[model samples]
Target: MHEKLTIDIETTGLSNQDEILQLSVLDTMTDEVLFNSFLKPSHIKAWDEATKTHHITPEMVVNAPTINQIRDAVQKLLDKASLIVGYNHLNFDNRFLTKAGFRLPERQYDVMLKYSEYIKEPNKYPEGFNKTPYKWFKLVDCATNLGYDWESRPHDSASDARATSWCYRKLAEIN
Candidate 1:
């Protein structure tokens, strides 16, 4: 009976060199926000393109705590949970966390991957051919499909974590 945690991150960019600007995690069973913060990057300035997508500006994070400052607390949260869940954590969020030097738990579930696999139309392809790859869906779209209304902004990490938890529960109920 281990705890399940849901996480989401807002970053400077999509590349490996990019930094995490914000991180949020929630306890899935209790819907409690375990950790959330805006991180100040030590290097790599200018996130114009990423800013356009997440709307987190340099000014917003200028005085925020650096990832190192919060490392211990973040690690404690990570260590407490045996299962980590996120919308696109496998391909996206986890990379940013690892790049920032956090040791993650081995057990993780990607809600995006689950939903992608769940709704896949394998029969649409030829019988002899390999099934098409699972298509990724946006977090907002998953929320919409699950009929979950968001209480906060979309791109914000905390809100996304909440939405991910909501969608995960809905997906679990049916599956």
Candidate 2:
């Protein structure tokens, strides 16, 4: 296992070029939180249903830092990692990140779709791997099966990223 940072980002909607509302990162190897911050959205077109999902209103994002500032803050953490893990990072998070003007040097390791193909039986061997092209997996489902009581709550990136890291660590041990 590499020195990994489990990460998640809460944004205004779907585009990194858009506005990043919050960020959460954890170094699984050290079990320490590396970065956690809420960003002020520079591009808030509307605070409707999309904003409701995260439960963070535009007012809350007002005091948040600029996207560039947040990116600068995480530069060290980003540079320290070779792989970044997230639930739907490949398709979603990265898009937002790129849009936010941050370039990722490390490889994107998606954990949600990656574990989706593995059988869950105690003695079951990992099968149906090649059937899916996904590399990451859903932390909620995986964590629950792994006996973790932590549930994903809205707008809590740190907790969610750490939980996902925990799920991955536990899975790696099993393998």
Candidate 3:
């Protein structure tokens, strides 16, 4: 069966130096959770803002495995997936994975980009006026727009992964 993996990550910060606090991967075709875990941080410190967003505390990851320890298993899941997808993965999640030394597959899809194209509003202008308009939607916003309700807390990697998978399915139906 052709399988696509939808992933979501909670991180310590936005930069490359940041650590991935949590990782979630789900099989889109089967709705199966392939892998999910809170990674023990080795270098970066989690910021308050990040903690506020993902709610991943240091105590939560105190007994979790580090990325280095789980890299092989994570790679196995990735290798099995025909395509790896996420809401804003290309810009965010992939960077953290790369920084953590995980080699990713080239077949990647960004649900946010697909949703953007699916919901884009054409600019309207008065006579003799010209402008290009754009609309950007966050994962939660997109999920809400598509009538996706979270089964668990938002920002938790597994919950976010499930939500993203739902969004991807919805977007696929429309497109």
Candidate 4:
């Protein structure tokens, strides 16, 4: 059976050394949350900048499970998923997941890239240099554009994963 999974991860920062602060995965077809949890960072002592964007503080994940503890289960979900979907996941979330020792499936869908092309939002770049690229949309913006109402905070991994799945479905309808 082919399974589509939507995943999202929050990290300390956009660096190879940044630890994953949270991870969420959902069944795209059924919208079932397969996994959702805050992860305690292994090395980082602070994440003020990331906290500002995601609102996940150190204290929030103090007693959370470490990545190693949940690696096997998450990897199993990844292995079962035929296509993993996320917003800007190709550029961001996957990198963090790979760095944290999770193996991702080869089949993946980047909702941000596809939705940007669909909306025809131009990227901020000089004109007449080359072909213009589409501006990636945030998960919240994509969800809002598709009339998806938030049930919880936006930056939370579970919330982001849900939004990504919803956006993917909405975009699929118009595609």
Output the number of the lDDT-best candidate: 4
Q: Which TM-score value belongs to model 1?
A: 0.91
lDDT by residue (61-140, candidate 4, tens digit) is: 99999999999999998988889999888888888888888889999999988988898867776265323487766788
Q: Could you give candidate 3's per-residue lDDT for residues 70-128 as a string of tens digits? A: 99998888877788879888877888888888878889888887787788765354232
- For model 3, name the residue pairs that clash: none
Lowest lDDT block of 10, candidate 4: 123-132
Clashes of each: 0, 14, 0, 0
Q: Candidate 3: misplaced stretches above 4 Å?
A: 122-133
Q: Give each model a TM-score.
A: 0.91, 0.80, 0.89, 0.93
Highest TM-score model number? 4
Residue 150 local lDDT, model 2: 75
lDDT of each: 0.87, 0.70, 0.82, 0.88
lDDT of 2 by residue, 1-175 (tens): 3367788887767643456778888886665888888888775756576677777777777777887776786866777788888877776787887777676766766666556645432323335533344333456767777787775573578877877787677767876
Where's the lowest-lDDT run of ten residues in candidate 1? 123-132
| Tens digit of per-residue lDDT, candidate 1, span 74-141 | 88888878999998888888888887888999999999888878888444444433333766679998
Candidates' RMSD to native: 3.5, 5.1, 4.5, 2.5
